[model samples]
Target: MRAHHRSRLLAATAAVCALSVALAGCSGTTKKDSKDDAKEKAQNAKADPDAPLKKGLKIAFLPKQINNPYFTVVDKAGIKGIKEFGGKGKEVGPSDPKASSQVSYINTLTQQRQNAILLAANDPNAVCGPLKQAMKQDVKVVSFDSDAGKDCRHVFVNQAGSDRLARQMVQDLSRQIDDKGEIAILSATQNATNQNTWIKIMKDELKKPRYKDVKLVKTAYGDDDDQKSFQETQGLLKAYPKLKGIISPTTVGGAAAARYVSGSKYKGKVVLGGLGTPNQMRKFVKDGTVKEFLLWDAQHLGYLAAYAGAALASGQITGKQGETFKAGKLGKYKVGKDGEVVLGPPTVFTKKNIDKYDF
Candidate 1:
């Protein structure tokens, strides 16, 4: 299944590249023309600085929810990066992961005249209004982990490529279930940009010939709360008696699902995998409830986002494709089309190698 998926992905990627070249030729525009158009678009984009931010910038980070373990670790790393770059960093957000919870914080940050606001949006569109206002006020908005609308943010610091993460989750589940049977997704929030994007890709992956036997039974949201996620997992098992595997792509949801599976009747029968920290999933991996899971370094993701925010604030890069910046300890990163800076590929964790990671 893995080999088949890889081949299909490679073929699809080549086709897309070919289509892009064909389109460029058909448009009767030179490569220089395309580059000039891109530059023009970047110049027209609002809230870019006239010069690179060298020092004395104030950056604030807003995660989906405050006090969550995953965001806590990530935000701490972001703060470290900000200080390293000679900027002041502040972390603030709501305790709940609702779409509207972040609006007040954004307004506050704007009023405080923050140079940059780094955020992980709970809903793709719900926060766009405030973010747009922030941009109007000269606040550089860079989203990480999750994204707001493209017009609302300067750039997105993606933890991993969406297609890669989605395919990997599907592949992991297929391996555990031997390429067959029913599977379900226990995701964070229905409105979460990252979760929704990954779920859409997972659905597309299910249509491939290699996954023909795999049926996606249901998708449930837990709102990123442990008790709610545990209950949602219980409901899924009760609702789908033939469920062979489950994928929870949020750290909170993954750990909560694992906890429920480990203590329930589904412990040995059902396979669980998704994004989780080593500290959170250690027991489940050791007890055989979960075989393998995948996640990137959340701290590194935060670190890269901080640097991107600083670059935008300083006018080093205007969130344009091919724009490059140096991230402390993580080396250089370039923005792709749509102003996305990918951290890297995700790391797969199994019982054999899970112990080596602490976050």
Candidate 2:
């Protein structure tokens, strides 16, 4: 990553961390929950080397938000993985995606004594203090999709690098518009770490001489809400009528953007692409409103996150780079330097290949 890009990533991470710290400061309470867990875990660790086996455990897959199609897919996959492994796991998140909301959930989960927490932090480090407390209490902390504090989470399950996802979007959108004309990005929250990272990458990629003809008019935030995304799409069209393309890296934002276009005369005039569910993007594909889009198998992202969490919980593998573990049907995987398990490359969605995928 370039210095500017790296700075943005760190800034996003710091913003989240600052939120967590502020919340902690306001509460003025020590991590009593984590402490209790630590005492119990320590006793169990000494009593039985295979201590986790002696207890019924609850593992949480905490995404940035719940009910969104993207995280829903992940939740479904986590359910399957946990059931297969004979452990309890479920998806839990705030109704809306907010750093403060996530802090509340983390505190509640810690109070409930969840054995492990796999989070896709809404803000880069907003939930870090609570997560750190969980770790202190011997509650395993792992991150997926987006990361929290590095020292707080034992492992981070990454779908891919921000640059990789951004590059793919740029290539897809640029190709649709013949690499010329104005393009606008429909982003999620301005503070969303993953989206901002990808956006930075997209901006950097656009700066290359090969894309000199392509002008990025502006970027707008939808906050990952469907209605907001739809409105944002309209705003983009009004703000840049000559806009040749719109790229929304959020699942909801992309789908909503497509729907808005589907109802307008600009349907074919403006190309649309980004991260959207196959089911949601089907109509746009059929109507030729969207030429192409891309996303990973979200369920698999969740399944892999769970497997990684279980490995860390049982001490089967530490989140060290180059260390590999068997993930049943998903096969063996290695952790990267940042403790993330890359699910695989993003799968491009077009009419021809779209039918082959269910999630």
Candidate 3:
């Protein structure tokens, strides 16, 4: 199978900043400050994998965007997995992937008496209050693809380990650019948890001896919109004519960047690659607009999340380190620190292998 993708976290808009400036009472709270204590309390809950999954369990997969092709594949796979365990499941979310857009769904799911809510958090903390409240009502929360804060969910089914993903992206771009040139990032949102985390690791990865000549020029936000990402790609090129490559770590942004570059004069001159689905990226790769990109099996990611949620909802386990549970047909998985359950590494998709997979 070829490379696949994921999206981003939070971003403060100009209007938001303006409002914050007008209201000096705006308090700044980093991710750690608001979540560390609560996370510690939540992690104290123990696991019991020996118990059987409850019958008639209702699992809801709330993706970043229900309409997004990436999330569509994942949530559908999750729905399939839920049915396999004799649980009722459905995919529900907003058209746009944003933190504020998800709260209402969480509340509705909670009211509907869902046994579990699998989320792909747009922001680490934006939906925390609602999620915590859901937990209070005994609704097991499992976040997948992207993550909510540790304190906010029972388990985070990550597409892959952050460091590994970061290293792969940095290396992929570095290779495409021949390791010596100016590069920029076209990311989903300004404060997206997954986007920022991967960017941070990519920045650190750039510091290694092998990538000494690679200079990072900018990191632009696209708000996960296709047109915005196309414009951002244009802007990056115009602003820095010497820029040799662009990395877009979100599916929307990656495909948009490629679309822009494919028609522009920089088509073959500028290297573009990042997280992308084979379906969306196949044309770009075949056209030579993108050489390769990275992503884990999103189908498995969603499927695993359903099983993990069922485990939590059934008293089979809590989000504790070292807890293991069986995901039907996919085998067993162990919980890691911060209640993380990693799927595995991403695959690279070029013209040679892009056709082999179709998610």
Clashes of each: 2, 4, 5
Q: Name model 3 segments beyond 4 Å from true.
A: 1-46
lDDT of 3 by residue, 189-305 (tens): 775789989999999998899988999999999988889999999999999999999988999899999999999999999999789999999999999889899888878988999
Candidate 3 residue-pair clash tally = 5
What ordering of candidates by TM-score runs from best to worst? 3, 1, 2
Scanning candidate 3 in windows of ten residues, the lowest lDDT window is 1-10
Pick out the ten consecutive residues of candidate 2 with the lowest summed lDDT. Answer: 46-55
Model 1 misplaced stretches (Cα beyond 4 Å): 1-42, 45-53
Error of 1 at 34 (Å): 26
Better of 2 and 3 by TM-score: 3
lDDT (CA) for every model shown? Answer: 0.88, 0.81, 0.87
lDDT of candidate 3?
0.87
TM-score of 1: 0.86
Model 1 RMSD vs true structure: 13.8
State which candidate has the highest lDDT: 1
Candidate 2 ranges with C-alpha deviation above 4 Å: 1-55
Error of 2 at 187 (Å): 0.8
Global lDDT of model 2: 0.81
RMSD in angstroms, candidate 3? 13.6
> 1-359 in candidate 1: lDDT tens per residue?
99999999999977877788855642445554331343345457654434555798899999999968999889999999999979999899999999899999999999999999999999877898888778877788899999886777889999999999998999988988999999999999989999999999999989999988999999999999999999999999999999999999899999999999898888999989889988899999999988888999989988999999998877778887887888878988888988899999999998999988877
Clash list (residue pairs), candidate 3: 9-192, 9-193, 10-191, 10-192, 48-316
